[model samples]
Structure formats: structure tokens, C-alpha cells
Target: MTRLILPLLAAAMLALPASAQQAPTTPALNLQQNMLLRCSAAFALGQRLQQAGAPEAAGWPPLAAGGREFFVRSSAQLMDEAQLSREQIVTLLTRASQDLAREGQLARVMPVCLQVAGIR
Candidate 1:
């Protein structure tokens, strides 16, 4: 399970930028920003799960790392693709952090994370 999930996580990270680049303009899904937000939530949730000693936490480190990298890379892509300034990215991230914090536990956020990463 660990082996399988790790590869899926890595592949999701790699695929994110390409998928964002190819996303149609004016689509309902804001893929780039949504990915960043979901990954941020996932990172936070992973930390909490690890602290609680959940068995599923075994994959948290890698998922969190990949999510972080994906967040950084995707935010850059958002800058170029959406013409958003660095200030805007920071603001958006801050908002995402706050919103996710209010959104409760790992169970609530995990599905969004998986969806954003295109893992499910």
C-alpha cells in the first residue's frame, strides 16, 4: 500500500503542471489554485494524522512533501498562466490556509486533496 501510494503521489505531483497548462480557459474548475489550496490542506491534515499515530499516516511524509512541491510549482504556473502577481499568490495561499483550518479533520479534506491531485 505504501509503495503504491507513493508512486501515485509522485505521479500526481508531476502531472499537475501539465494538466494545468492544458486546462481550458473559462472552465469551472480553477485547477491551478484549487490544486494549491487542496495540497495545503492535505499537508496540514497529514501533520495532524502523523501526530495522532494513524496507520494511514505512514504515507503522510511523502504526500506532504509532494504536495508542497506541487503547491510551489503550481503557484508559479498560476502566475504565468493567470497573470497573478506574487502578492496575489501569497494572499490566496493565506486565505486557503485559513479556510482549510476552519474545515475540520483529515477525513473532510482528504477527498478534496485526492481530487485536486487527480489521484481519484
Candidate 2:
């Protein structure tokens, strides 16, 4: 079951629009949004794993903590690169979480996150 999920997740990510894969750059901000975006997805996946009583729930805290740290540490760089405020990034994270939940993609979360973290 797990073996099949990674490819599907990769395909799903690939299917997203190029704009969705990259953040809009403004005069003040010019960083690629991939890191933040992947972290956001991982964070959301962690939340879903926890809610679904999945065994992977045990990994959520570490994932969430790592994501938070990455976001905080890179916020200045990301903000400067994309002209996005901290609040805006938070909003993006929330929206990402909500979207994942709404899409019923819980089964895909764990494997995607593991891939995001380079664990699998």
C-alpha cells in the first residue's frame, strides 16, 4: 500500500500548476517558494495523520516542530524574496492545511511528508 503512494503523490504535485509550485515574486521578495510550500504540506499532512489515528501520528510532533523551525528561520529570506508578510505566509499555511483536509488526501500525506523530509 505504502509503496504505491509515493509515486501518486509525486504525480499529484507535478500536476499542480507551475504557478502553484512557485511563489509570486515582487520587487522586494525574490525567493523560490518551494521549501515553504513543501513544509506547509508536511505540516498539514502531520495534522491529518494525527486526526485519522494513523500510526504515523507518532511522527507529527517532530515534523511539525521541524516545519515551524524552518519557517521561522527562513521567514526573513522568504519575505524578502517574495514580498510576502509573515501573516500572509501563515495564511498560506492555513489554506494549505484546509485544502488538504477538504480534498480527502489523508492517505497521501504520510508518504508525501516522508518524501519531503527525505526520510523515505
Candidate 3:
């Protein structure tokens, strides 16, 4: 047992520096940047759908859905890395939803969030 213990500890110690020396991953974009990108992408996607001739109502849904998925993903990341609160994330998502809803692709952008989520 004593022999096994020393070897294990020695191995662990040796591994630590190598692990540390491995450059950490470049930091991910923060919540705001991610949200901006997601919202913009959603808008672009929505515009494409509109141009493809989807009804205004139907087109909005997919964009909103895509946007929400991104929001959820961003919230999880913010919580994990930055310790942001759920409320803050919610507020951010809400504001983003409103902003995206107002884009020119939308005609009567009422309650677009559910529509986006409902998209496959």
C-alpha cells in the first residue's frame, strides 16, 4: 500500500505541469456577444424564410424559436462561466427577443418569441 501510494502521488504530480502547460482554451465570447450573434443570425434566417414566401406569422416563429434556443444555450454558459443570475439572463433574453422582433423582416411583430421556438 505504501509503495502504491507514493507512485500514484508521484504520477499525479508529474501530470499536473503538463496539464497546466497545455494552453487553456481561448475564452469563449461573453453572454452579450453571443446573444448579439444569435439574434442577428435569427434575423437573417427569418429574412430568408420571409423571402422564401412563408407567411409572416409562420416565418417569425422559426426565427423566434432559433433565438430562444440560443438564449438557453447562452444562459447555461453564462451561469457556468460568469456566475450570472437566472433573472439577469432572462432579462437579457427578453430584451433580445424584443429587439429581434422589431427587425424589418417582421411586419406586425407581436409575440414573436413563441413563434420562433415553435419552429423545428
Candidate 4:
């Protein structure tokens, strides 16, 4: 029993590193779906605000909020979408990962998209 246990433990130890070294098998989902979802939410919010007789600027809050969410979600989705095309994926992943390191970039862009969407 002791001899068997030792070999089993050794095998398990060896296998662990090999498994860890393997590239991730599962691909992540992309940002497009998330962006669409967020946009939908923002649009809905804007409609509600308008119906409630809130100022035009009221939509800005939710729109801006959604824009930021969309950007982040889109960035992640872009990373995932890259899987469909390996070369493009590498470039996008690198860019997206790098951009993520910069603080407030998403927030900055959010208002612009929201503005374009007529949120304010």
C-alpha cells in the first residue's frame, strides 16, 4: 500500500505541472453582446426618464453609465472575439490588455458615446 501510494502521489505531482502548462481550453465570450445589452438597458432607462418628464440631461446619467459599461464589456468581448481569428485576436488582446492598465479611459469615452446617442 505504501509503495502504491508513493507512485500515485509522484504521478499526480508530475501531472499537475503539465496540466497547468496547458493553454486555456475555454475561450471567453466577446464584448459585442454585452455592449448591446448595456445599450438596451440605457435606452430603456432613457425612455423611462423621458416619460417621467425628467430633463434631457437625466438620460445622460444612465447613458454615460451604460457607455462605460459598454466600453468595458466591448473590450472584453473584443478579446473573446479575437478567438475567431487568431492573428486579429493577438493584436486585439494585446491592445485591450494594455488599455485596461490605463485608468479612467473608459469613463472618458463613455460620455462621448452617450452624447452621440443623444443622451444629453
Candidate 5:
């Protein structure tokens, strides 16, 4: 998965559209959404670290536990604040992640990714 992340990042960067750097079409995420996004990235990056057998990841069992908590709260927020069913939320997340991955394909995002994960 760690190996895949590098190639995925490269391919995603190359596939970015010229307009991806423009402002978003939708409203900003609410507070819950903000937490969800951070936790989601942390969880994903943490998992990638673990999969690569990083020694520090052993300290992150609590991270997985925290992910479950976030998932629960985020799940509830999906229905209440977002008025989205779980399946719809899943679709939206998949699409949004894909979009982010694509925007990440843009050169503008590479330096940030490299700084964060040495993936460039």
C-alpha cells in the first residue's frame, strides 16, 4: 500500500485538471466535517505508515481506536447535519476523495505531499 501510494500520487498529480486550483463549488465543511477530514487523513496516513512497517506506527493502535470514534460521529453527522444516508455518504466520499486525488495530481499539491510523506 505504501508503494502504491507513491505511484498513485504521481498518476493522480498528472491527471489533475487546469482548473483544480480554482475555488470550490460548494460551501466549506462544517466543524464536524473539518474534524472528519483531518482524522480521515491522519488515519489513512497512519495506516500507510503501518503497512510500510514503520516502527513508530506501533504507537498508533490508539489511532485506529480513535478512527472508530470518528467514524461513529461522522456517521451520525452524515444523517443529521448532512441529511445523507450512509450509502450516499459513501458515494460522496468516494467521489470527493477521487477529486482530491486528482487535484493532488496537480503540480501545486506535490510539494506539500512530499513534505508530508516524502512521496514526490
Candidate 6:
């Protein structure tokens, strides 16, 4: 997933495959779908953390409430770009986040979550 997303999201370094014919802002359905899927997963984690009342870490930069909103709004764009319904988007996000949580992968992915949430 990072292989695909890093290319697309890494500060204008977009070198999309033929399938990703659309512009970076709007990837085609097959345009490295995992990029948005994984990002949405990270965003889902952010929402969960917010709902759980997790405080800002003492050392890390403070996480603003708007970060979650950014992810939520971005999810809509993801769905629209891929022509997916809300339920489909929700399912993808839920499954990815759940799998990561079940496998105790949060520690590995929190940095990614923070990045996707635009924390830095």
C-alpha cells in the first residue's frame, strides 16, 4: 500500500501506472485503490482514538479535532473518485482498520495514521 501511496502522496511525486490514468487528486477505481483504502484505515483509527478520549501525547504535537474532519471529508472524495457508495467505503475502511487492530499492528501504523491525518 505504501508503495502505491508514497508515489501518489509524496509531495507531488506522482508517477502513476497506466491504470491510474486520472490525475492524482482523483485516482481511478483501479489506480492503486489501496492507497486510499489504507489512508482511510488510518483515518478510521484516528476516529476511534478521538471517540475513546485519548489525550494528545505529552511529547507529540497536539492532534486537533479538525484532523479527523479532514479524514472524514477526504473519505467522501475517495468514494466519489472511485465511484463507490458510502457503504462500500465504510466497509473497506472498517475491514482494513479492524484487521490492523486485530493483528496488533497499530504500533506499526500510528505514524502512518498521523501522517494521513496531516498531523505534521
Weakest ten-residue segment in model 5 by summed lDDT: 104-113
Measured with C-alpha atoms, the lDDT of residue 21 in candidate 3 is 29
- Across 42-100, the per-residue lDDT of candidate 1 in tens digits comes to 56556555656778666544454555555667767777777775544544554455566
Where does model 4 exceed 4 Å of error? 1-28, 56-120
The model with the greatest lDDT is 1
Ranking the candidates on lDDT from highest down gives: 1, 6, 2, 5, 3, 4
Residue 16 lDDT, candidate 1, scale 0-100 = 53
Candidate that scores best on TM-score: 6
Candidate 6, residue 51: lDDT: 48
Worst 10 residues of 1 by lDDT: 1-10
How high is each candidate's TM-score? 0.51, 0.48, 0.36, 0.28, 0.43, 0.54
Model 6: per-residue Cα lDDT over 1-120, one tens digit each: 222322234222233353332322333456446655765565555455544566622333434454446556667777777877554554455556667666447556667656756676
Write out the backbone clash pairs for model 3. 61-115, 61-116, 64-116, 65-116, 65-117
Give the distance in Å from residue 48's predicted Cα in candidate 6 to where it truly belongs. 3.2
Clashing pairs in 2: 29-80, 29-81, 29-82, 30-81, 31-81
lDDT of 3 at 22: 48
Q: Ten consecutive residues with minimal summed lDDT in candidate 4?
A: 1-10
Rank order (by TM-score, best first): 6, 1, 2, 5, 3, 4
lDDT of 2 by residue, 68-110 (tens): 4454555565667677755445445544555665644644654
Q: Over the full model, what C-alpha lDDT does candidate 3 score relative to the true structure?
A: 0.46
As for candidate 5, its clashing pairs are: 12-105, 13-105
User: Can you tell me which runs of candidate 3 are displaced by over 4 Å?
Assistant: 1-32, 36-54, 57-70, 105-120
- Residue 64: error of model 1 in Å? 3.6
Error at 82, model 1, angstroms: 1.4
